[model samples]
Structure formats: C-alpha cells, structure tokens
Target chain A: DQQVKQNSPSLSVQEGRISILNCDYTNSMFDYFLWYKKYPAEGPTFLISISSIKDKNEDGRFTVFLNKSAKHLSLHIVPSQPGDSAVYFCAASKRNYGQNFVFGPGTRLSVLP
Target chain B: DAGVTQSPTHLIKTRGQQVTLRCSPKSGHDTVSWYQQALGQGPQFIFQYYEEEERQRGNFPDRFSGHQFPNYSSELNVNALLLGDSALYLCASSLGEVNQPQHFGDGTRLSIL
Candidate 1:
C-alpha cells in the first residue's frame, strides 16, 4: 500500500501565478512532511518542510500547509517562475522508527511562460 | 560546499547480472539514505546508514544490500537483477539523522535489458 500519494501525475500552470501541489497519506504515525524538487537527471533538492506541531510553514515564495486530522498536505509556490518547473515529490517521516520516510509519486509541474 | 555525489550517471545491465551504485554524502554530513524510483512512481526507501552502520531499513528484499565506509561514503548492490529492477537509484545525505532535510545527488539511471 502506498502510505503517501500524490494523485496528480502532472500539473500545468501559467507563469506569475500561484501553483499548488497536493499530497495525502494513510499513516497516522507520520509527524513530519517534506517537499523536494527534481530536474531531469538530477537528484531531488530540498524545498520546504513542516512539522506536525504546526499547520503552516513558509519560506520565501514557498509555503506548506498541513491538515493533520485529514492526513493531507499541500505545497504552494507564489509567482511561479519557469525555473520552478520540475517534478515535485512529497515525503513523510515518523520518528518512532529512526524517522523512516515514505514517499509519494511525484507531480510534474509545467510552467508556461 | 560539495553536494551529494553519485557515480555512473547511467548503466545498462542484463538479467542475473549484478550492479553496484556508489554515493558520497555532502561534506560534514554523516548519514546516508538510499531510494529507488521507478518510472511513473515515487521513490521507495531502501535503507539508511549512520556512523558507518545501518540505522534503519525499509521494505526492500535481500537482493538489495548496501555498505557504508568509514568516510561516510556508501555503495548499493543489487544481485541477480531482473528486468523489473530498472529504475533511477538515488542517494541522499543528512546531518544528525533526525529527519533533517536530506541533500541528494544526481541519480544513476540503471536500465535492465
């Protein structure tokens, strides 16, 4: 079973607009969430993360919102830029077991200039 | 200043053949985590090593094994490979192993022919 899932295989958005990516999980044990962006032939780069203790965390133009009870989380990028176009993966971790993580299929964000 | 580095940018293997993928964590980092990403799917965690010892493991089977050296470099080995083993193998490193965000390297694309 996939503990974490990103339902959208891809998302298309216009530049300078807000781009939102969503993710869901079935494991209540997960207490931390992270988002990573990957370019072709490259490893994923850390984007932003949020702890279960808080519902929202923001960094520059990126913000992550978590709904613990719903086991859902989303990442938002304001004023989407062309450089932001990439495959975004969502991952969850539970500290109970050395913070082991489960990742979801990524969503490819295509920004149209 | 160095990011995680992985070797053999790409590889082609046959069924039953063994392959070794290598990784060097970012400077000053001590923890290494391995993941496998199949096409159209999210990455699956294989395991994690800390202080030259495996600190955690995921659901992968015995065919998939790894070793970490004293310098925190790591190698992932796949034995008796199958066509299904084709995918991108990624290595990530973190500091302190506390669910801290991990830095990744450009993965090795392994194709089974």
Candidate 2:
C-alpha cells in the first residue's frame, strides 16, 4: 500500500510565479513531513519540513503547510526560479517507527523563464 | 564534514549475479538507511541500520540485506539479482533518532542485464 501519494506527476510554472506541490498520506500515525528536491543524477537535497504540532513551516522561498484533518500537506515556492525546477518528493515518518521513511511518487516541476 | 558517500556510481550485472554497494555516513552520524528508486518512481525503503544492528525494515524481501560497521558505515548486498532489481540505490545518514532529517548520497545506478 502506498502510504504517501502525490497525485500530480508533473507541473510547470513561470519563473516569477508561485509553484505549489501537494501530497497526501493515508497513515494517520505519520506526524513528520519533509520535502526534498532532486536534480538529474544527484541525490535528493532536503528542502523543508513540518511537524504535526505546527500547521506551517517556512524556509526562505519554501513553505510547507499541513492540515491534519485532511491528511494532506503542500509545499509552496513563491517567485519560483529556474533553479527550482526538479523532481520534488514528500516523505512521511512516524517517530515511533524508528526513522523508516515512506516517500511519495514525486512530482517533476519545471520552471519556465 | 563530508555528507553520505556511496561508491561505484554505476554498475552493470547479469541475472543471478550478486552485487554489493557501500556507503559512508556523514561525519558524526550514527544511523544509515537504504532506499531503492526505480524508473520514474519514488524511493522505497529497504532497511535501516543503527548501532550495528538492523533497526527497521520495509516490504523488501530477504534478497536485499545490509550491514553496519563500527564506524557507522554501511553496505547493501543483493543476491541472485533479477532484472527487476535494476534501479538507483540511495543511502541516507542522520544523527540519532527519527526526529532528525536525513542527508542523502548521489546514489549508485545499478543496471541488471
């Protein structure tokens, strides 16, 4: 069973506009959510994360919003830049589960200049 | 400090052959996790080693196994390889517990013929 899912396989946005990526989880035990950005032939780099206790977390141009009631979360990039184009993956883990992560299928985001 | 490092950036093997991949965790980190990413799919967890013992595992079969050394480095061993095993293998390291975020390596691309 896929515990986490990213419904959109790909998305495109203008460089100066906002980009949003959504993710959903079927497991209610997951309390921590994270987003990672991956480039071709490279490992994914950590982007932003949010804890269950918080509804939102922001880091620079990246922001993550979580809604427990909906079992969903989203990553928002304001004024998206060309460098932001890559595959984005959102993962979830339960603290009691000993750090084993469940990752979504990933969304390929393209920022058009 | 160095991030997670994986050796043999690429490897090709024939069916039924056995292969081993290595990983060196980031400095001062004590946990190591392995993930497999197939074409156009998100990574799926294989297992995690901490304190030189297997702490957690995912849905992977016994064909996939791993080891953690005293220095916190890790090795993933796959036996009786199948064409379906072809994928990019990723290693991630974190400090202590599930709360800490993991940093990943560039990954080793494994192709089975």
Model 2, A14-69: lDDT tens digits are 99999999999999999999999999999999998899999999999999999999
Candidate 1 residue lDDT tens string, A16-36: 999999999999989889999
Model 2 lDDT, residue A87, Cα: 100
- Model 2 reaches an interface RMSD of 0.7
Q: What are the lDDT figures for the candidates, one per model?
A: 0.92, 0.96
Best by DockQ: 2
Which pairs, if any, clash in model 2?
none
In order, what fnat does every candidate score?
0.84, 0.86
Under CAPRI classification, how is model 1 graded?
high
> Which tens-of-lDDT digit does each residue in B3-113 have in candidate 2?
889999999999999999999999999999999999999999999999999999999999999999999999999999999999999999998765788899999999999
lDDT of candidate 1 over B9-112, digit per residue (tens): 99999999999999999999988999999998878889999988888999888999999999999999999999999999999998865668888899999999
Clashes of 1: 0
Q: Model 2: DockQ against the native?
A: 0.89
TM-score of 1: 0.97
- Candidate 2 CAPRI-style tier: high
